[model samples]
Each structure stands twice: as structure tokens, then as C-alpha cells.
Target: MTCFGPRQQTAALQQAVPKTRVQTCNSTPVRADGEFVLYWMIAFRRTEWNFSLQRAVEWAVELRKPLVIFEPLRVGYRWASDRFHRFVVDGMADNASRIAAMKNRGVVYFPYVEPERGSGNGLLAALAERACVVVTDDFPSFFLPQMVAATATRLPVKLEQVDANGLLPLRATDRVFTTAFSFRSYLQQELPPHLAQFPQSNPLARIQLPAMKTLPGTITRRWKPVSKELLLGDVAELAAFSIDHSVGVVDQRGGATAARQRLQQFLERRLAHYSETANEPDEEARSGLSPYLHFGHISPHELFHELTSCECWSPARLARKSNGKREGWWGMSTGAETWLDQFVTWRELGYNMASHRDDYERYESLPDWARATLDKHARDRREHVYSLDEFSAASTRDPLWNAAQTQLLREGRIHNYMRMLWGKKILEWTASPRDALDVMIELNNRYALDGRNPNSYSGIFWCLGRYDRPWGPERHIVGTVRYMSSANTARKFSVDGYLSCYGEGTHR
Candidate 1:
């Protein structure tokens, strides 16, 4: 196995600094300064196995100063919703509870209610009065990139980001991946050496500082309180918002406990069929851990540790290999291997583009051929153009697309394959390729549990050929961009079953 030496160094630094993984600025906090640490909880919300959080812990321990975590959620951020808010509120509740255990280790939890709170001013900045540095989640795409860019310039203290989403931070990949195969090849060559060791936290035992004060009694009492105004809001008001509300706030649970349980369930039951059924929309075979992953409720390191801890691989044993070359252990099922590839290699590919490329979220950021094809097809005849409002309302005539939208509405997510088709249809039915891309992003970010994610951005771009190649003769609507039809999808998969489950012919 080719050693990902630099990656190993990055991992070590991440563990040592704790904030390195999530820090966007890439500078290490100056520990000798005796400044307290600020854990700017953004993308990665969980407290455990968080490189950013750990980095704060490191600073606290070294400087004998307090550590404070600030998590602010602003309203009107595109698809901000009750569902998303509830998930985050629950996570804040979780953080409050967990941080209580750390005592004087100093942790603060802030859950902002947007407009009412007014973009919630800087508790982090105030905390930085004595802060050694500020560390936040290192997300490439999404609104976060803009947030961090602005933050890096504004923060008086040094700003760093630690990546806790993908198994390997997207920046670890040297070049933008053109396809899954190329990305997969690189991951296969790199994962073994670096994936073996996980980041370890700086134990609390050494930091026997004063007990940290808990959240103010008022904040604790008001935690996740019901919103009477929201309950009273008109249906049209609710509908106008992009955020998903179908999965009631109660259904959208968050926090580390829920994230961990979800991961376990996937590995124990669903993983066995991952290879065979993950693509079957009706199966709902995916791990369902994505939202947690997206929210940083569970760490990638924690997930990998669980996988490696299973000594007796469920359903079999790995065959012993005598070859000098390092190969996968025998007895590992295809399902296990396949899912790992998605989790580590393919998913990381999205991160790679997001981190390295400025236009990662734009149509122009797609591969050269993809961009050319989309430009060529920009003026092609679109059979049925729909406005963003029409698409958001699920008013499109195509039942498959409607069904997919319904699934997204009710479940707070869509299945993986259906998700692909969802974006493709947006591309096909919109007046121009760019319009399709915009609609795809708007809709996906608004409803999907995994919306507003790097993957979602990459998925939308993929419909325009980000990680794919040219195929066949250029066609209208899609140009050289890949074409996917409801008919073709129907032929390949059982769309009827999915539609039936959500109730066909019902335009609600």
C-alpha cells in the first residue's frame, strides 16, 4: 500500500491541534500565548471525536485556560427550517448535557433563533478576549465557505478549520477528481496506511481546571421550546420557505446518541445489503447516517473505529492472504467493501472539489467536457420548462419526479438513485442548463435531510458532468451533459413501487 504520508502528518496534526481538521485557515493556534480556546461549532456539531473540539481541548489543557464552544444558527439561510432547527436544537441540548461532564473544561452552547436573535452576535468573539485561537468546521462547499472566508478576515485571533466530515479531508486529494474510478483508485492506494490510526483526544484527566459553568438557567429552560408563532403561521408562509417541514420537528432528532444509534443500526442490519440494494429506491437500504454525518453528530473516525472493531466480520471470515502486497482481508463481504468505497473514496471526492476549486458549486466548475456540453446544450429545446416555484411545489407533470419530491418532502430525504434522477430531471425540464442547476440546488437544499451538503452540491453538478465523461452524440436539453430520463430510470428500476408507496396520482 502506498503510504499517504502527508495525510498521516495531517491526521497527526489534526489530533495534536484538534482544530486542524475543521480549521479553514490552516494555521495552528499559538498555545504559548495562554489564550482560551474557542470551538466555533459550525459543520461538525458533535463534541466527541471532533478534531476542532479536540483542538480547543488541547489549548485549554496547555494554557490552563477555559474552552468555550459557540454554535449559532441563523434563520433565512436558504432552506433553514423547523426540521433543521429542531435537529440542531437537540444537538445543543446534547452538547449542554455532555459538556456538563467536563466541568471547568469550559464549554458554552448557544442556539440562535435567527431573525428574532438577529444573526446572533459573537459570543465567540467575546470569548476570544482570552482565546488562543478560533477553530471552526472546514467545509468546502455550502454557505460555510463564504462564512469562513469572512470569518478568517474578521476574527482578531488566528482562525483554523478541522475537517470532520469526509474520512479524508477534501484538501487531502491533490487534484480534482474527474471520475469515481480515478478517485476510487487514489483512495484504494491511500486509505490503508492512513486509515488505520484514528485521532485520539487529549484526555481530560490532565486538565483538572475549575468546573465550567453550565448554560444559564433561562437558556436551559427555554431549550427547544415550542414556537407559537410558527404554529400559527399561515400555510402559504410555511410553504414559501425552502426548509423541509414534512418531517415534523419531533421526527428530526439529532445529537451524538441518535447519530451513534443510527450508525449501529446501519452496520448491523443494512450494511449486509448495501452493495445489492443501496441503489433500489424502494429498499431504503442506505445507512441513514448521512444527516448525522452532515450535522457532525458522529465523527468519521468514530465510524471507522466501529468498523475496524468488528473482529468477526458478520456473516463470514476474511480469507488469509500470503501475497507480499497488502490486499483487503478475505471474508469481508462485497457490501462492506462497496459501502466503504462510497463512505471514504467517493464521498471524499466531493470534498476534494469543494476545498480545492473555487467554482465547486457552480456549473462552470464541472469537468471541461461537462462544461462544454452544458454550454452547447444551453439553447437546446427544453420540452417542459418549469419555474423554481413549480419545481418546489412538485407541480411537474412527471410522476417519477413528483414522487421523488414527495419522498423528499415527507421523509426529509430522498434515496440515493432517486436523488440523482431528481437533479437530472431538474436539468432537463428547466429553460436553460443554468436554471436547471439552480432549481436543483434550491430544491435539494430545501428538503433533503442531507441537503445543503457538499454531496448535494456535487450531486447537482454531476447532472451537468462534474465527475463524469462525455458520452454518445450531443443531445438537446442536456447537450454533452449526461441525459437521464424517467423512462430510462423506470426501465432500470421499479419507479412504480416508489411512487405507489408515496401515493401515485396525488399531486400533494
Candidate 2:
């Protein structure tokens, strides 16, 4: 490996970068002599519409070093299985092609799949050893923050993290909001200035590489990438790994290509009818993009910019004023407005909460009011109590409840509207609120493709009254923590239709 001297950039290029987007991880000295700028692509998997990738390119250009994207997946996360592994490998399969194309343009892409447990443990540190500066995604939840923290402790050169996860910068809010209204108000007031600076969505568009065409011989000899055949739909690889095998692969494929296809399908066919049928379990009309968003196959900014501004549409068409209301600002169709709220306010709100609190997922972290109410009703009796096994097997008494759980078991996700009822009922049936929380986390994190996301914690904790208010006429077991009745929920939509789809073979 040889060092490339620090390169100079024009004022225009420097000004294009946003200061708010970058967060310095360590104060270690930036190397004046190192092989290349390294990007450890953990969360944001795509090549385009990625702030982290863009920032890496900027650093590589400014330092006159080739960009090295080192992405490795260890088959040892808590719930690693054929299902999750397949989705990720599918995305990597896409990334492999994208990286191969960039090879001609001086971007060195190394995709590694851990052959066994603990194989990829020291990957980032090894890459950082020879690099000028290491840059990675600033994801706050799951094992990502922990992984980056571990790497930051040992790296000698500078390490930087870019928040490419959400529209709201996690650092902007000092505290988490307890409600959607409050966050939306803060969002409306704060987001205007930052919106003007978008990420270099297509990092490959402008080809500016270091003079060197080849990577460090040491890197090539020691860290050769796995075969492309292994990157694509290789479920058989899971058998060699030490993780759960019962939970199976999902039918929906994973990758940037698949994500874009899903997004286009959503915009073209479903966006028009979204507002009306989004919550209806029978219709299956929502964007169907959460899995992609959670895994970083796609980005919120990409989807948001696309939704707000297309050839036929613009945010200016938004007739509704930013009055701190949930909908209307986009002055677009009902579907777009409804989705924008979910995409920006709600999704980012969860991201904001997780980024600030280390114990964001804990039961004790629930709002004071919620904790009080649940404590008040802690001794209340339950008419039905089921173990975690019953829930996982989808053997609950309620047909709707069983159907939702079955959907999770089979499809790796539950429909959004049914998902709420799924949590609320689990609250009702579990012997204790603490037990309910544990159950939700296990079932979700183990099965749902989008389970490890901030939204997953948000939805789970929301069931126990996080980001919510006490309702009138406090009910038993749940008390004032907002009760949802299964019967009432069943009547809200086509219950029979839901039962017909996920309820097959399993008894109600």
C-alpha cells in the first residue's frame, strides 16, 4: 500500500458539502499519507442517494485518494436466519454489480460474507489500519452504533459518521417528543433550511479518481471478495452459520434494484389510492418499502425527494399550509400527504428518539405517565394468557390476532393496520406489561425484516404508551395507556379478508 498526498478542491466543490451532515467520531489526526479513503457500508447499502457515500467521495476527492467501500456481513446477529440473510445477500448481489461498474472509475468495492460466526468481527478495524480516514453510516439503533463505537476506539486516523438515515438530523433535537403533534411542529419549523442541501444521490455520475488504477496489493491478497454466485439468493449458506434456521426467507427480494421497482410500483399504482386504502388490511395498498428502508437498500431522502418533486408534481402544489397539522403541507393528493407524514415525521421521530437515548428500547424508558398508568393496573387479572410460543405459533384465540401473527411468521411482516392491533392484543393477553414488552421484542426482532429498525421500537413502545397520551375512561389491564379492542378493530376493516389470507391451515 502506498500513500496519496492530500488533494485540493475548488471552492464550488467544498461549498456543495453540508456541515450538518457530518459528525466527527474521534479527534485522531487525519493521515496525510495513506492508501485510500475507506467507507464501511453497514446501514446505507445503496450506491446512490446516500449521504455517507457522497461524503466518502468528497473526502476521497479532497485527499486525492481512491475510495474503498468495505462491506461485510457476519451471520451472527441475534436472529440471523435464512429469511434475513437472503434479503441482505440479495441486496449485496445488487451492490456487487454496482461496485464492479465503479471498478473502472477507481472505486474499490469489497463485499465479504462471513463463512461462520465471528469471522467478520475485526473487518472494519483491519480496513482502517491502512486507510487515510474511515467513514461509515451514523445509524443509532440495533447493533450498528455499538459496532461503530467499537471501531472508533481503536482507529488511529480520523473517523467520521454521516447521518443518512432520516430527514431530521438526530443531533438537531436535544430531547425526544412525546407525541406526533409536538414533533411535527418542531419539524415544520426546523426542516426548511436543511432541505436545500441534498446528498449526491448519484455518486458515480462524476468520475474523479486518484491517479492509481490498482488497489494496495496487501488488500487484494489478504481480503479478496467472495464469489458473486454466493452474493445472490444463496439461502444454502445459512446452514453453515450459527443462527436460527426455523424462520425462513421472505418472498420479497432485497436490493436497490428491487427497492426502486417497489417504489415505482407504489408511486404509479398505489399512491393514488393510498390515503383511502392504506390502513385496510384487505387491500395491501401501502408502499411495501419498510423492509428496504430498514435494511438500507433504499433511503428516505430518495423516496421523499421523488414523492415531492417529479415532472408532474412539486411541493409547491401542496395547498395546505404548514400549520403543524399531520397532513396538508404538501398540498398534494391525500395519499401523498398521508405517506409524507409517515415517512418524514413519524419515521424520523423514532430515529430522533433512538439517537438520543441509550436505553430507548427499555421498559423503564416509557413516558412517566405511561409507566404510572401501567403500574397502577399492574395487578389486574387477564382473561387469557399465552406464552411466547403460543404467540409465535399464531395459536391465539382471536382469528384476527392469529392471522396477524401468522403473517409475521410466514411473510416476515404484518400489515400496518393489523400490526397495531397485534401489539394491543398482545398487551391484553400477556400476564404483565413487562412480559408484553419482552414478547413483542422477541417476536418482532426474530421474524420481521424491518424489526430491528427504530420504527419497530417506536411501534412496540407505542403499545405501552410511549409517544402517546392517556385516554379517558381508563380500561382494565391497560388502564389509561390507550386501549385498542380486537372486536372494534375487526369491524374497522375487512376482517374476513385478512383471515382468509394469513389464517389458512392454522386454526382460529
Maximum-lDDT candidate: 2
Tens-place lDDT per residue, model 1, 1-508, is 2233334434554446422244447344464564456777888887776767766677666666666677766665666777677677667667766765755445554544443333345544555555677778777767888888776776677777776666665555578777777776666555453453455532332455434555445444544322343323223333433454554543557788888887888888888778788888644488787888888778777776566444233212333332222225323557767777777666777778777888777777777777777777778777788888888777888888888887777777877888888888888888887888888887787777677777887788888887777878777767766788889998888777788776455543
**Number of backbone clashes in candidate 2:** 5
Off by over 4 Å in 1: 1-35, 101-119, 201-207, 214-250, 311-331, 505-508
TM-score against truth, every candidate? 0.83, 0.93
Give Cα-based local distance difference scores for all models.
Answer: 0.67, 0.81
Query: Per-residue lDDT tens digits of candidate 2, residues 1-508?
Result: 1111111112223345466768888889779698889988899988987888888888888898888888777777788888887888888888888877765456877887777777665566767887899898999899989978877878988999998888777777697787889888887778765565566667765668874565567655665566565675667766766667898887889999999998988888888888888888844498889999998999887787667543245334544445788776655677887888888989998998899899999999999989998988888999999999999888888878988999898889999888998998899899999999999999999999998999999999999999888897989999998888778987787888788888857432
User: Candidate 2: where is the Cα deviation over 4 Å?
Assistant: 1-15, 211-224, 311-321, 504-508
Error of 2 at 426 (Å): 1.1
Query: Which 10-residue span in candidate 2 carries the lowest summed lDDT?
Result: 1-10
Clashes of each: 23, 5
